[model samples]
Target chain A: MISLKLDKKLDSSEGEFLLSIDIEIPKYSFTILCGDSGAGKTSILRMLSGLMTPDTGRITYDDTVWYDSRQKINLSPKDRGLGFVFQEQALFPNMTVRQNLAYALAKGQHSKEIDLLITEFQLDGLQDRKPATLSGGQKQKVSLARSIINRPKLLLLDEPLSALDQKRRMRLQDFILKAHRDYDLTTIMVSHDAAEINKMAQAVLSLENGKVSRITRPGEMKKVSEMTSGTITKIDESAEELILKISLKKKSGNAFQEEYATGEMIWVSKKM
Target chain B: MDWQPIILTFRLALVTTIILFFVSLPLAYWLAFTRSKTKPILEALITMPLVLPPTVIGFYLLVAFSPAYQFGGWLESIGLRFAFTFPGLVVASIIYSLPFMVQPIQSGLSNLPPSLREASYILGKTKISTLTHVLLPNIKPSLLTGIVLAFAHTIGEFGVVLMIGGNIPGKTKVASIAIYDEVESMNYAMANNYSLVLFSVTFVILILVYLANGGYFNQISK
Candidate 1:
C-alpha cells in the first residue's frame, strides 16, 4: 500500500490555491485520478512519482519512507522505484527503440525479456528506428515498453492515450491492460475520459478545486443514465439502421445520440 | 608569407574548443535545469563575454594572470605563467569565447520537454548518466553549433589576444595578430593572403555547420 498525506501551495493564472490531499492508494489496483482541468490531478501524480515534493506531509510506499517532512527525509526520484509514461511519449529521440528499452533494463532482467517486450508491444520491424521516424501509436508503444522494462513497483501514466483516434486508442488500451496484468504493477493514471475511467479503473478519485471531493468504486459509480436527460429531436434511417439525435437538457444548441424514437425523452450520456 | 601564425592560431583554437567542450557540458546542464535564486546572476556572468568589450576582458585577465597577484603568483610557483604566452592566449580565448560554447548547449537542454528528464529519473538513472546517454545525444545540432561557433570565434579573436598575449612571434603571435602586423608594415600582399585564407576557412565551417543542422535557414523559414 502507498499512503500519502501531502499539501502544496500553487500559484496559477487563475489565482493561488492550496492542494491538500490525504489518501491511500491500494496495491495492484488500477486507480484513476479523474477531474476536470486545473484540479491538481497531474500535480498529485508528480508527487507520487517524486517529481514534485509536497510542502509538508508524509509519503510511504510499503516499508520505505519516500518522503517525510518531519524527518526531513525526501528521496530523489532516482531512489524511488517507479515508472512514468508522459502525455507526449518522451522517448529519447537520439536512441533507437531497442536502445531506448535496453537503457531502462532493471537489474536481474534478462536480454530475452527485451526481445519479448519488443515482440509483445508489436514493435518488431521498428526496433532500429528513432522516435522521430515512428508514427504516434508506435511511439507510444515504445514509450510504454521502455517505462516497464525496469518492472517498476508503481507505474504512473499521464493521459498516455489522449492524442490518438478512437480506433488506435482502443488498440493501445488493450496493450496497456495486457502489460499491467502481466507485470502486476500498481498503476495510477490521470484522465478525464469517463468511458476510459469506467472501463479501466478499479477506483476513481475525483478532484474539485484541488481536493478529493469524491471517491467511488467503478462498479458503484452512477452510469450514464443518471447524469444526462435529453429529448429526441431527429432520427436518421438512411443507412439501414436507426439513429436518434438528442438535444440535451439546458444545452439546446448541441445534439447527442442514443437509440430512441422521435418525440420521446431519453437519458443519454454515453459519447457517440 | 609565414605560415607559423596560421598553424599556431589553429592549434590554440583547437585546444580551446576541446577544453571548453568538456568544461561547458556540466556548466550548461546546470544552467539549463537549476532553480537556484542566483541563476539569473550566474547566467548574466557567463554571458557577459557576449557584450563586454574584448579589451576590457583582456585587461582584467592580464591583471589576474600577472605574477603580482596572489592567484597568478600561486600559478607561477606551480610552473605555469600566463603573461604574454601561448597559455595566456588560450586563457584569453576561452574567456572571450565562453558564450559561444555555452549558449547553444543551454538552449538545447532548456528547449527539451521536461518530461524527458523526469522520465529518466523515474527509470532510476543518475543525473550524470541521463545527461551523457540521453540529454547530450539528443541535442546534437546544438552541440555542433556550440563547438563550431567557439572554434570560429576563437580563430577570429583580435583584441583579447592582442592585450593579453602581445605580438610575440612563434609563441603568442596568432593569425589575427599577424594580419595586424602585416597591415601595419604596409605588407598588403601578406595581409590579403591571411585575410583570404581566414575568410575561406570560416565560410566553409559555417556552411558545414548549416548543412549538419539540416539547413538552419530552411528550418527557420518553415
Candidate 2:
C-alpha cells in the first residue's frame, strides 16, 4: 500500500490555498490524477518520485518511509523504487535505442531481457537508430521501454502521451494498461483528458485549487452529484450575474429554492 | 632534413591539447549550467585570453616567471624553472589557444537540453558520471573540434613561444620558429618545406572536422 498526506504550499498558485491532500492507494491499482494545467497534479507526482520536496508531508510505501517532514527523512529518486516517464520523453540522444534500454537495466542482467523488451515495444528494427532519428511515437515507446526495464515498484507518468497523435496515444495507453497488469505495479498517471481518465482510472482524484476530492468507482458521479447537490448547475450563457439555483428539502417536506453565483462550486458539498 | 623541430612541435601540440581538454571540460560545463550572478564575469575572464594579443600574454608570462618575481622565486626555491624551458612553452601555447579550445566546447554543452541531465540525475547517476557518460558522448563533435583547433593553434604559434621559450635550437624551437629561422637566413627551400607541411596538416584537420559535423547533421535531418 502507498499512502500520501501533504499540507504544503505550492508556488504555481497565487494565494496559499489548502493544498492539503490525503490518499491511500491499494497495491496493483491504477490511479489517475485528473486536473487541468497548473493544477498541482504534476507537483504531487514529482514529490512522490523525489524530484521535488513537500513543505510538510509524510509519504510511506508499504514498510518504507519515503518522506516524513517531522522525522526529517527523505529518500532520493533512485532509492524511491519508482519509474517516472516525463512529458518530454528525455531519452539520451547519443545512445541507440538498444543501448538506451540496456543502460537502464540492472548491471549483470541478461541481454535477453533487454532484447525481449525491445521486441515487445516493436523497437527491434530500430535498435541501432539514435533518438534524434526516431519519430515522436517511436521515441516515446523507447522512453517507456527504458523506464520499465528495471521493473520499478511504482510507475509515475506525467502526460507521457500528450506529445503524440491520437492514434499513438491510444496505442501507448493500451501498452501501459498491459504493463500495469502484467507487473502488478501500482501506477499513477497524471492527465487532463477526461475520457482517458474515465477509461483507465479505477479511481480518480479531482484536484481544484490545490484541494483533492477522491471519487471512487461504482456510481462515483452520482455520489459527486449528491455531494455538490445543485452545484453541478450548468453555466447560463445569457445571465449577467452567472446565476445558479439550489433545491433544498425543508422540514415541511417541501422543496426550497436558493440562487447563487457560479463561484460557489466549493461551498456546496453533501459532507460539508 | 632536420626533423628535430617538427618532432618537437608535434610533442608540444600533443601535450597542450591534452592539458586543454581537462581545463576546458569543466569550464564549458560551468558556462553551460551555472546561473550564478557572476557568470558573465567568469565568461569574460575565459574570453580575455582569446581576444588579447599573443605578445601581450607572452610579456605577462615573462614577468610572472622571471627569477625576480615572487612566483618565479617560489619555483626557483623548489628547483623548477619556467623561463626558456619546454614547460614554459607549453604554458604559453595553452594561453594562446585557450579560446580555440573552450568556445566550441561551451557551445556544444549549451546546445544540449537540460532535460537530459535532469533525467540522469533522477535515475541515480552522480553529476560526474552524467557528465562523463551522457554529456561527453553527446558533444563528441565539439570536443573533436576543440582539440583540432587547439592543436593547430599551438603548432602555428610564434610570438608567445619566442618571448617565453627564446627559440633554443632543439629545445624550445617549434615548427613556426624553425620556419622563421629558415626565412631569416634566406633559406627559402627549408622555409617552403616547413610552410607546406603546416598547411597540409591544418587543411586535413579542418576537413575532418567538417566531415564529422556534416555527418551528424545529415543523420539528424533524416
Candidate 3:
C-alpha cells in the first residue's frame, strides 16, 4: 500500500491554489486519477515519483517512508523504485530503441528481458532506430515498455496513450493490463477520458481543486440518460445524499440544475 | 620570421579550449537548469566579456594580476604569477572567450525537453550520468560549436594578451601579437605572412566546424 498526506502551493495565471490530499492506494489495483486540466493530477504523480517535494507531507509506501516533512526526510527519485511514463515520452534521442530499454534495466535484470519486451511491444525491426525516426505510436510504446521493463513496485503513467490512434490504444491497453497483473504493479494512471477510464481503471479518484471529491469503483458508475439531450457536469455529495447537476438548457431553461436522487451519473463516470 | 609565436598561439588555444570544456560543462548545466531569480544576474555577468571591449578587460586584468592586489598577492603566495607569462596569456584568453564557450552549450542544454532529465531520474540514473550519456550526445553540434568558437577566439585575441603578458618572446608573443610586433618594426613581409597564416587557420577551423554541424544552421534558418 502507498499512502500520502501532501500539501503544495501552486501559483499560476489562474491564481494561487493549494494541493492538499491525504489518500491511500491499495496494492496491485489500477487506479485512475480523473480530473480536468490544472486539477493537480500531474502534481500528485510528481510528488509520488519523488520528482517534486511537498511543502508538508508524509508519504509511506508499504511501510517504507518515502517522505516526511517534519522529519525532513525525502528519498530521491532514483531510490523511489517507481516507473514513470511522462506525457512527452522522454526517450533518449541519441540512443536506439534497444539501448533506451536497456538503460532502464535495474541491477539484476538481463539483456534477454529487453529482447522479450522488444518482441512483446512489436518493436522487432525498430530496435536499431532512434526515437527521432520512430512514429508517435511507436515512441509511446517504447516509453511504456521502458517503464515496465524494470518491474517497478509502482507505475505512474501520465496520459501515456494520448498520442496513439484508436486501434493502437486498444492493443496497448491489453498490454498494460497484462503488465499490471503479471508484474503485480500498483498502478496510478492520470487520465480524463471516460472511455479509457471504463476500459482500464478498477478504481477512480475524482479530483477537484487539488482534492479528492469522490472515490468510486468503475463497476458502480451509473450511465447518463441518453434519451435526454443533456450532459451531467458535476456531482455534489453530502452526508445526507448525492446531488447531480446536469446541464440541460433545453429542459430547465437554466444552464444547470441540481436534482436529488434523480442522478444519472456518478463522479468520474465510466459511461460518458 | 619567428614561428614560436604561431606555435605558442596554437598551444594556448588548445589548452584553453580543453580547460573551458571542463569549466563550462557544469556552468552551462547550471545556467540551463537553474530556476533561481538571480540566474539572469549570473548569466549577464558571464556574458559581460562578449560586449565589453577587450582592452578594458585587459586593463582591469593587468591591475588584478599585479602583485599589489589581494588576489594577485594570493596567487604570488601560492608560487604563481600571472603578469607577463604564458599562463597569464591562458588566463586572459579563457576570460575573454568564456561566453564563446558557454553560450552555445547553454543554448543546447536549454533546447532539450526537460522530460529527458525527468525520465532519466525516474529510471534511477543520477544527474551526472544523464548529462554525460543522454544530454551530451544529443547536443553534439552545440559542443562542437562551443569548442571551435573558443579555440578561434583565443587564437585571435590581442588586447588582453597585450595587457597581461606584454608580448614576451616565445612565452606570450602569440600569432596576433607577433603580427602587431612585425608591423610596428616596419617588417611588412613578416607581418603579412603572420596575418595570412592566422587568417587561413581561423578560416579553415570555422569551415570544418560549419561543415560538420552546418545542417543545424540550415534547419534553423528555414
Higher-DockQ candidate of 1 and 3? 1
Cα deviation at B196, candidate 1, in Å, is 1.1
Candidate 1 residues A1-272, lDDT tens each? 99989999977668989999999999999998988777788888898888998999999999899999999999998888888999999999889999999889976778888899997786899999899999888899999999898888888899998998654665677677777888999999888876567658889999888889988896686574344456667776543234455454332235434432223222212235
Task: List TM-scores for all candidates, in order.
Answer: 0.89, 0.79, 0.87
Q: For candidate 3, what is the DockQ?
A: 0.66
User: lDDT tens digits, residues B1-222, model 1?
Assistant: 799999998999999999999888888988999999998998898899999999999999999988999988999999999989998888888888989999999999999998888888888999888998889898989999999999999999999999999999999899999999999999999999998889999999999898879866666677
Higher-DockQ candidate among 1 and 2?
A: 1
DockQ each: 0.73, 0.45, 0.66
TM-score of 3: 0.87
Tell me the TM-score that candidate 3 gets on chain A alone: 0.81
* Predicted candidate 2 versus true structure: per-residue lDDT over B54-160, tens digit per residue: 78989999999998999999998999788999999998888788888988999998898876876676666678978987889999889999999999989888889
**Rank by TM-score, descending?**
1, 3, 2
Number of the top-ranking candidate, with TM-score as the measure: 1
What stretches of model 3 exceed 4 Å from their correct place? A222-272, B68-70, B216-222
- Local accuracy by lDDT, each model: 0.86, 0.81, 0.86
Candidate 2 local lDDT, A1-272, one digit each (tens): 99999877776646555578888888899988887677788889888988788889899999899999999999988788678888898899889999888777765678888888886777879999999899989988888888788878898888888887655676677678877877778999988764467558887888887888655673464433332223344444332223233232222224323332122111111232
